[model samples]
Target: MEDDMLTCNSVESPGPPFLDNAASSVATSLRRCANDKLPVSDNRDTTVSRWRKHCPTPIENDNIFEIETHCKDPELCSTLACDIYKHLREAEAKKRPSPDFLETTQKDIDTSMRAVLIDWLVEVSISRKKVTEEYRLVPETLYLTVSYIDRYLSSKEINRDKLQLLGIACLLIAAKYEEICPPQVEELCYITDNTYIKDEVLRMEASILGCLMFEMTAPTEKCFLRRFLHAAQLCHEGPALHLEFLASYITELSLLEYSLLCHVPSLIAASSIFLANFILKPTKNPWNTTLSYHTQYKPSTLRDCVKVLHRLFRVGLGSNLPAIREKYSQHKYKFVAKKYCRPSIPADFFQDASS
Candidate 1:
């Protein structure tokens, strides 16, 4: 019995202290996001600004309590859900920031490295599309990968050779966090056409985990959408299903531009839900009396998380970059591509890679 108790305690205990540095780093990122309105906005210059006008701004409502109460009836919520549709329409209006803009200003990557990274990014974009289409991966998965990669590269000097490996690792980590049951190591290896061995992938996974401090509970874009969808009472069998697809689309665009990260997930989710509602139910009375009655908050008065995400989507659409179409292409990867890849980090980012 004593041995059993000891074993249980050991099993439940948090692992080694290598996570301390990672935890501090992530904490710093989160703090920066909180402090600055434009925290992640740096990488998205020239290519992102055009979409600013295209994103929809939800109508300001004085009474959030009314919106909340009206949401109790799922049917009314579905029809009145104005956030998602507005977001999509807005997203359609703007253009994505060019890949060149990111390549130009990033401290870690020079011109040569940027060009090389773009090639790998093309592969990443394509791989993500295939995986999402085939496995029904959530848009959040791709978003998480972009977030991870962006954060990692912010301070690292990753070599062009290992870019794809970094992308793969990011995707794998995201799948484990967002998917119901992630594909096994061998399965992922197979998917990559044996470009990476199972063990190599595993090592990359460990490296990623170590970097993020294994603290994974940051609210995803989906989490926010679900909250407001439920609060607005729009989640029904038919509407809920369609709304999910729209949410995925909205989240996918946010990945290319990091500025959206500055905003709260709740705001983004709310905007997407409302916009989707509007798109699906166009003729429904825009004047939802229940909105003012149930909602305790004001849409326009609060921080503009939804508006930012919507803008990013619009920017990508305007850029007319082949990423959207190219992302869906199903091409096999080459083995040499994986073996020569290096991390996209600067030397000073981490004192110890193993940790």
Candidate 2:
């Protein structure tokens, strides 16, 4: 299969290189960091400060070892790990695999691990929400944000304290990637409630893009379902409304714990559509028709995807998605008529939790 994507030029530099030392010693030091629960800030800051002081100016594409040391600092261990990361990244660049590989397939993640993932997403979303700016485009804006954290965690032992900063950087990157009008560096500082420095956000952004190898073709719920809905000829207004509702709800839930690596844009979008259809049109029998068409192309089963999505709604949404009805009352939403709240809903519509 010809991967047209790889042929495109995406110069994601893997920073600098590390030295060649004993792997066991490096592993031992990292183990201590994890066992002691050394604040991620301590390690991360140390590595970053080191990079700023010792790292090359105008970083070269092959200088990955220097960057790897910033990930770990034990004098000898840092050298060893940097060397390895540099070599691996070189191999990867030659082959050019997609960066969204972490969440590419559920089979790669044990069935039992899905719940843990949901919990992680929920925690990230709630924390980010407390500090994120209002009018931040779509809910899946947090999807890629969470993905950066998960991808880093899979290989490194980062303390939870730095998670928010990482989240901020990821969001900043996603905003630029997904939104027409991206937020400014100062605006992002405000969004993170001034938790991180502007320079830190900039550095983190470069690191994340590097970590993902500048590959960011992950699918969002709407992106996934739009193609499927069109091919299935389910593009009427009624279906559109339902899909919007479901996509919003599901995508929000996804922000809570779902990793962008776990599903393709199409899979995420299609799965949400299936769940929404199941919830709204229960009378429609044989839901298989909704998914049967995409089975050939996707690596996952439709039933499995739907099951995962429904589980996400139940846990991630926290009992029916902070119902706008119970909180604001139908009168505020114009008795659920979508009239006053349709084209021009009040600012508070989203400002409030129900929104």
Candidate 3:
């Protein structure tokens, strides 16, 4: 099967690599900031069927790894996990922000300004800044906040002056939904240097909720990434945890690229997993039958998205927006932001074994 995407020259690097990726050590397989490349495991030669898929594989093969064994953990919602996630998948469309809002609706702002707002939001959530203590919003809250900003912008037009205010209101609303102890509205107001009064923030919050029809439970890339990572982890023991962090790093990088709005959350999650696997284990095929079954996407389906994300990875390494790169480079996150891979993915990797 010929991949027509390669001939299109979509993945070709226009200039320098973009995304900021690095990792902390968990023994020898993981690398520190100095090691630009992730060292392949000593067991790289071992053939694990779960990590590498084969055709005509028995039906029980995929289930055993993701369900039969993983669901045994007491913390997991084992009995209802499948049904719960099934519903989330069904609900993604309703929550998806307008993919082309910048072109169709907004007259005052463009992609760069939206990118700037997201960068600021990242700082508001996790960075150490003006406040005596960091605000520390959850990752889901940030994703939801961005969704709210985009969804609200999809229908309404506002000038650049109010963009930051809209971001503040969205973050407050998202923190309320996803955080156990949400931030005080006044504290959020403080984060903005009191640019908008308390009442103004509250009014924007009301506007956002009303515009969204009060539906706050929309699914995000992070929501589906957890499930896809479970399937991707299967039997890969040494790199499992690092894989999660690295994949997440890739997904977050995509948030800065407004063009990615067109792709659905599930596709973004699956593509991030694919890219992370290649970065960590370049010698082996990244996508297996298990991933295909779980994500309901073929390697071919993820071709364009993976390439676009890789472009972000290459460009974001030295991007002006340093919040995501700086945060992920910490020791706790395994320093995934600094982990480097080959400049370009091989065109053939997108093809299945059967192809």
Q: Flag regions of model 3 displaced more than 4 Å.
A: 1-64, 128-131
Report the C-alpha lDDT of model 2 over 287-351, residue by residue, as the tens digit: 33223333222223344555665665544445433432222223422232121211221222112
lDDT of 2 at 65: 31
Ranking by lDDT: 3, 1, 2
Off by over 4 Å in 1: 1-140, 178-180, 234-244, 277-297, 301-315, 318-355
Taken over the whole model, the C-alpha lDDT of each candidate is 0.49, 0.47, 0.80
lDDT of 3: 0.80
Judged by whole-model lDDT over C-alpha atoms, candidate 1 comes out at: 0.49
Question: Where is the poorest 10-residue window by lDDT in model 2?
Answer: 341-350
User: Can you give the lDDT of residue 96 in candidate 3?
Assistant: 87
What does candidate 1 score on TM?
A: 0.47
As for lDDT, the candidate ahead, 1 or 2, is 1
Model 1 lDDT tens row, 1-355: 9999878877886665355878978988988888796544444323233333343334343433323334445554433344543453344223122233344435444533433433344444344333445444655665566656655555345665556667777777887888897656676666567788878888877776776667444445554455455545533334454545554455544544445544444445555554444444534422142332222224442335444543544344343344532442223211111121121212222121122
Q: Please write out the lDDT profile of model 3 over residues 1-355, one tens digit for every residue.
A: 2587654554684433443333212333343533656444455224233334432333334344554345556566654556666777788877788899999999999988999899889877885344366656679998889888988999889999999999999998898899898888788778788999999999999999899899888899999998888888884555677999999889988888898998988899999999999888887788877887677778888999999988877777346689888889999999988888778888788986457
